[model samples]
Target: MLINETIITDIKNIIAHSKDKAIKAVDHQRTLMYWHIGERIFEEEQKGKDRADYGTFLIKYLSEQLQPEFGSGFSIRQINLYRQFYRTFTNVHTLYAQLSWSQYKLLLSVNSQDKREFYIAETIKNNWTVRQLERQIHTSLYERLLLSNDKESVLAVAKKEKLPSDAKEIIKDPMFLEFLGLKKESAYYERDLESAIITHLQEFLLELGNGFSFVARQKRIHIEGDEFFVDLVFYNRILQCFVIIEIKTHKLTHQDIGQLQMYVNYYDRTEKLPHENSTIGILFCADKNDAVVKFTLPENQKQIIASQYELYLPTEQQLMAELNKELENFEERDKPKKEIQ
Candidate 1:
């Protein structure tokens, strides 16, 4: 005898709901287990006066004793990680259930309490996955926050007390385009790079930082009788505006900036809602001349930005050097213009 269609649908729904509940239960149990382990480790370390050397032999001894009986998840490294995890999060009640072990691990690596809290809140608010959490941490999300907003404002935004005004509030210049996987001096077409980004959209979105959602690829726009295609368009709900992105595999030129400006203007005038903020345009290019960028746009320009795209994550030393150079240039530019008096 065949089941009725309605009955079958009900059964399917029940199974799906049961699966979801089971997953949540498993997650809750895992989180509780880790928290308990952390508590025990903390208590044990406190019992010993010299906690500094407490972890040295603990992992090795535990691994040797537990591996044979309990098997996997008892490695020396994992044991040490548990110790560190305990040290990082002593308050079990404060732990967020939404975040997984991997997310917590990434959070544990961050030294600043405030920064860690910021990431935790954002992760929960945005419903970011473990991989997304890792990417944000690796990209120095805290540092990016510092670069974009004032200390108090950053704190407010991180806590979800205030919404971002525009994409510029979150999108970083010198975008980390390592997801494209393009090698230096490699011969490839622009389409190939675009395809690569499309394939790795998740990574790209993570690198794009927060509040970005893919809108279209090769999005067509019409102005008067002329038609143009934008490489990628994204909508940032937090900002309540459309973000137009143009990808260029070559050095940025005056004409490149002009074209992006047109797109921004078009979105601002036509596509944007009456209450929505102005559309922002990003010119993602292989190279950009800072001097040319400054001269090409008005001093008060806020909508259009030219940024360099890197095909790989830079080493710590390299990132520091790049940041320092940019800071020095900014300071020099900020120096008061000498009076002709």
Candidate 2:
């Protein structure tokens, strides 16, 4: 009698799943083992206050003994990582079980406590792989978010303490697009840039900040027999509105802003449901003149945003200058309100 094919298939599937489960269990146990090592190291250092200065030597000695008996897993670098992992998450009870040892190694490098906490929460929430976590840290995602928002607000966003109430909170200026692999001095058409963004859509959306989902590409609309195409359209779940984007590969003009505003108006008038908020329009340009943007839009404009995109990451000095300028603008905006009060 021939064996049933379905029975054989089911048996093979079960073996594969069991193998995966066993691997996960082994990885988790290894993480626990490292944590215990770190905990013991810390406790020993604490008991002898004078020996606290010997942390460097202590880790080296442990690595020497452990590497020979237990394989190269106990290298000096890894021993230090374990020590850092414990220091970073002091409470053993709060250790994240889902994160691999590799992910913990990355989180240890984040210097800021608040920023590290944000990354931890995001990693767990999104189920990020080791590579994704590395990418977010490398691109300074936290610092970029801080560009348009206060520190507390950024923390709140990370912790889900407060939802984004406006477009500014979610729209990042000078978005980093190095992942697109575009050259800084390359002369590419608007269509080419748009296509590159679509190709690396996930990275582009991450650079765009939170709660955005792609709706359409070159979304077409008809107005009184004339047809216009919006470069990209997205819906912001947090803001409960449509985000219409127009790409300009050159310096932004008043006319460019006007055209984006027209798209915003069209969506607001015809597409938006009564329950949803006003649609937001973004003029994603290669360069924008502040004076031109200020004079082009109404003083009370809140929905239309003009943001510049960068093909590569900005230098630390350049980022600092931009941050200072943003802070100055914030102060100026608050001054009028404070004086009125």
Predicted model with the maximum lDDT: 2
| lDDT values, one for every candidate | 0.79, 0.85
lDDT of 2 at 196: 96
**TM match of model 1 to true structure:** 0.83
Top model number, TM-score: 2
- Count clashing residue pairs per candidate: 0, 0
Question: Clashing residue pairs in candidate 1, if any?
Answer: none
Off by over 4 Å in 2: 1-25, 51-53, 314-341
Q: Model 2: clashing residue pairs?
A: none
Instruction: Report the CA-based lDDT of candidate 1 relative to the real structure.
Output: 0.79
Residue 35 CA displacement from its true place in model 2, Å: 1.9
| Cα lDDT tens digits for candidate 2, 184-282 | 988999999999999999978877877889999999899999999999999998899999989999999999988998999999999999999999999
Q: Write the per-residue lDDT of candidate 1 for residues 273-321, one digit (tens) a residue.
A: 9988888898988888978888999987888877677787777667767
Per-candidate TM-scores read 0.83, 0.86
